[model samples]
Target chain A: MGQRTMSDQELVQLYLTGQEKALAVLIARHQDKLFSAIYVLVRNRAVAEDILQDAYFKIVSTLKGGRYNEEGKFIQWAMRIARNLVIDHFRRGNKFPTVTDSEGNDIFTYINIPEENQEDRLVANERDSKLRQLIEQLPAEQREVLVLRHYADLSFKEIADLTQVSINTALGRMRYALNNLRKLIEKHNIAL
Target chain B: MTKKITQERIIQFVYGELPFEETAALFDELDNDTEGLDYLESVAGIGTLLGSLMVSPSKAIRDNVLAFSAHFTEE
Candidate 1:
């Protein structure tokens, strides 16, 4: 079996067995969802990068120390680790201290959108930026639920269990998050 | 009598976490309820917008992570 498709569990086992590249495969497979989950919560590229690094460092420690016994998906386990790092960040940083985007160089904002003229793309870009700003403005609790549900793909029950809140609160926050975003979009007259 | 849709069920329904029969039942239920329909549409739209959201950490950060794995040379 020269070229075998490895499951996440197999990749972890391979990495444990000293095949280092397996970890890279695991990271690459889930980077989009994992990084997006952290980025939306922190709302800054640099901080998100920091939290991601911290989360991965923690993952390495736990796995290498023979302590990672998480059942189910590796991405879910990684997502929880990332979310915990974000929570710790907020706790340490005096509760959402208006982080400025020092690394405002997301390559996606460059010539990314295909099949659109410059003017139309520019309008869409403005709308996207506005939406990002509104998401940033959301209360941290609301944003947490939003990310866990939309990005992490967690049900409200799981979110509630992790967050130590009632399922209703989780659902309520999600509703309010969307409603607030909708209101902000209307207030700014930004069309998506 | 129409079933009263709680916020919990609506959220589950929105995420398609509800069972097949329950999902169909709520779909029909939501069709008759404007507020529920609006919530469903609102969240679905916002989910799409949020779905487009993502950011990649710099290569340096990812390298640092991958490099950490190399430190473990033995099983």
Candidate 2:
């Protein structure tokens, strides 16, 4: 089987057994979602990047020290570390520079639709940008639950554990998030 | 008592969070309830749309992490 197709657990095992390239494969597989999860919380690209690097460094150290026991839960384990780092960043009152585009507008204010995909790109991009903006408008609690569930690929139960809330509360937040998004879409007549 | 399917339950159902029996029951109800089915479609659509918002760390960050991990193998 190609290294790309290996499961996260399998890759970790390979890395542990001295196949160093396995580590790179594992990181590549999860880098987007993991980084996006941190970015959503931090809302600053540079700070999120720093937190992501720190999280990866810690992940390597833990794996090397044989301290990682989660096996198949590598992403979640790493995400928890990243999440804690974000919390620490907030706790320290460290100010994150606002991310802006070339026009000096907040990056989150408008989506930069990628031009890679040809057909259906325009409609898809607009819909995506609208949905992103609506999500950004959601209450922080609801948005966190939504981001963790959708972006982080975490279950509501895991989200509850990470966010220090009950399972029901997590479910409730997600429900509210969707409901709010639906309302926003309807109110704005978003065609998606 | 048959659990009345609320929006919350619909959310759970869409995400496959309902228990097997509850899921079976919901599916049965969904076969008859056009509104429920539409709601499910909308929620699922939003979930898919959220996929476009996924962001990756810059290549520089990836390289930094890889470089950092490289040291562990060297040691």
Candidate 3:
């Protein structure tokens, strides 16, 4: 290919056609988002990192073998792989062990603060950590709907399609998620 | 010419999940009912907060992803 950048679909096509550069580009493009999603599920940096590697290896192998057919969906497919790896990691008793890295410990511990202005960057980070904690409190079904809808930016119809639920059910789950979160915030006196 | 709206329908209204006629009717109800209006506002606030819940990965996560990506580059 020329200096022109390729779309995810094009990269996938090239990878399927035995181009090594395509896989690298695709991995480079999605590595961060995939890792973030995996981190949410697994809650451990090292484990999430390990799972990301497994996900990339699987993605390259599957694409190169022509096993993945959906176009423009490389990230979603890679995320599915990463998610499965995280689930398997948890199933196998994976644990975080307290973070030893000073920077890692600081970021992870910053979740405990309350009453910060959104205009401040550090406060914005605190808000994110609070939201993640709120999500963890949600029931699994509702949590899944919230993550798929908000984080993945999947439409309700797309989520229903992915989760094999009816559109109405997906909407209802989101409704419940919001209601439950509202209750949790009130009960815990969590400042938003 | 309007049907009474319930709290349950407020979410669908705010999120635009309702059909056009229902949305119009809900707005009409809001104009006449203070309680419905308050409920609508609360639900909207919840939606706003929930919508902001996407968290950026922590530094460790960033480092891990970068390192993991580099491995693919190396191999």
Stretch of 10 with least lDDT, candidate 2 chain A = A103-112
By summed lDDT, the worst window of 10 consecutive residues in model 3 chain A runs over A97-106
For candidate 1, the per-residue lDDT at A46 reads 68
Question: Could you give candidate 1's per-residue lDDT for residues A111-187 as a string of tens digits?
Answer: 33442687766665555556777888888789888888887777787788778899878888887877788888779
lDDT of 2 at A168: 86
lDDT, candidate 3, residue A40?
58
Model 2: DockQ vs. true structure:
0.58
Sum up the clashes in candidate 3.
0
Report the lDDT tens digits of candidate 3 across residue range A94-187. 6533342443332553442343663465654545555667767788778877666555555676668777899878878887887788787777
Which lDDT tens digits does candidate 2 get at residues A1-192?
Answer: 655567889899898887878988888988888887777677676788899999999888888888878844777788899888988998999654555556454465233446556445655545554565677789989988888888788888888888899988998899888888888988878754
Top candidate by DockQ: 2
Per-residue lDDT, model 2, residue A134, is 76
**TM-score for each prediction?**
0.81, 0.81, 0.65
What's the residue-level lDDT of A136 in candidate 2?
73
Q: Point out the higher-scoring one by TM-score: 1 or 3.
A: 1
Look at candidate 3 and tell me the lDDT of residue B26: 76
Where in model 3 is the C-alpha error above 4 Å?
A: A1-7, A17-33, A94-106, A109-127, B1-75
Docking quality (DockQ) of candidate 3: 0.23
